[model samples]
Target: MGTRKFQGIYQLHYEEAMGKIQTGDLLFCSGSYLVSELIKKASNSFMSHVAFLFEWYDRVLVFESVESMGVRIVPLLHYMTNYKNTGKKYNGGLFIARHEKLIDSYFDQTLLKNMIRTGIDSLNRNYDQTEIIRILTRIKLGVGKHKEDNYEYICSEFVDYCFQQIGVRFPRTMEGFIYPEHIAADSNVYPMFEIVS
Candidate 1:
């Protein structure tokens, strides 16, 4: 087969992505370690795919690619849930992609910036739950001007979901269920499922 277009490999830039996690950065993250481990181990376990959602300080990033860690990118959002395993029959908080639907709700820079601001305001107002929910809602609903889903979905989709309204596609790699945007810099990481659950 020709090289895979979107493979399971860590592909988001650390600093740049973190920058997005500003005041309006609204998204629920389990924890940094869990998100980080998912990507590091996915590359090792065959199956050919990796997806993750990550957060840094405050911002959250979402990213997905089929060409492994360093290759082509197939970005998606707004209805996309968490990543699933390679061949698992069942999973949760994971949504498959429908290019058209995603393109309809992409996030732009200004919108992201504003969202960050919103998040900050929520935090300042002591609205932890609301802030997080707002962040995820914007991501899932697609707010902002540019309307591109660069790498923000990862963090945004960490909250509650009504997958029933949206169809989900199971992850196709060992490293599944992670948000696409977030990642741990360390080399030694594994998916939450791999941690002897």
Candidate 2:
């Protein structure tokens, strides 16, 4: 049999993909730890976490909101190769997706810079610990509307909020529901490369 593709696209070594990244790119991760597994199961998606990216001079930086460390920025290389300063590659798949809609004429350098600045300003924001529980409870109870608080965020919410800053809304139309799956399901978002860690 042919080698199985990661999310329907051939995987590439981390080094091979590093140079092709751009600002506004989306990073989707399928983590394997206990909390990762729980999040994936709860969301019914292989992707448990998501982050936004922007290039800084020469390095690409990942902006994300993680449980242990709220909103923060780190070089993309450090994140994929030596995750969390552990001196080891990340323990799961990491892929990049591009927004075809915004990458067009609609989104210009000004918006890109503004979005990057917004992400930078969001650093140190509180991570909403109750977010997972609330999302799970809403899902289980079939709640249609989700009230939102931008002050604190889960991973995906942070990504959404940053993109929303530039007036580029997520494709998911469901009221108050934005997650890894929803972002990946956006018709304009397409897989570009996967890290062969």
For this target, which candidate reaches the highest lDDT against the unseen true structure?
Answer: 2
Q: Residue 62 deviation, candidate 2, in Å?
A: 0.5
Candidate 1 regions off by >4 Å?
A: 1-3, 7-11, 18-57, 61-100, 106-162, 168-197
> Which regions of candidate 2 are displaced past 4 Å?
1-6, 143-145, 171-175
1-197 per-residue lDDT for model 1 (tens digits): 11122233233333333433322112222222443344324333212223333344453443332212321122122213323333322231221121222233453445444433433332212112333344344445654222222232323222111111123232221223323332221121222211100
Clashes of 1: 49
lDDT tens digits, residues 70-92, model 2? 99988888866688889988888
Give Cα-based local distance difference scores for all models.
Answer: 0.28, 0.78
**lDDT of candidate 1 at residue 151, scale 0 to 100:** 30
Instruction: State TM-scores per candidate.
Output: 0.21, 0.89
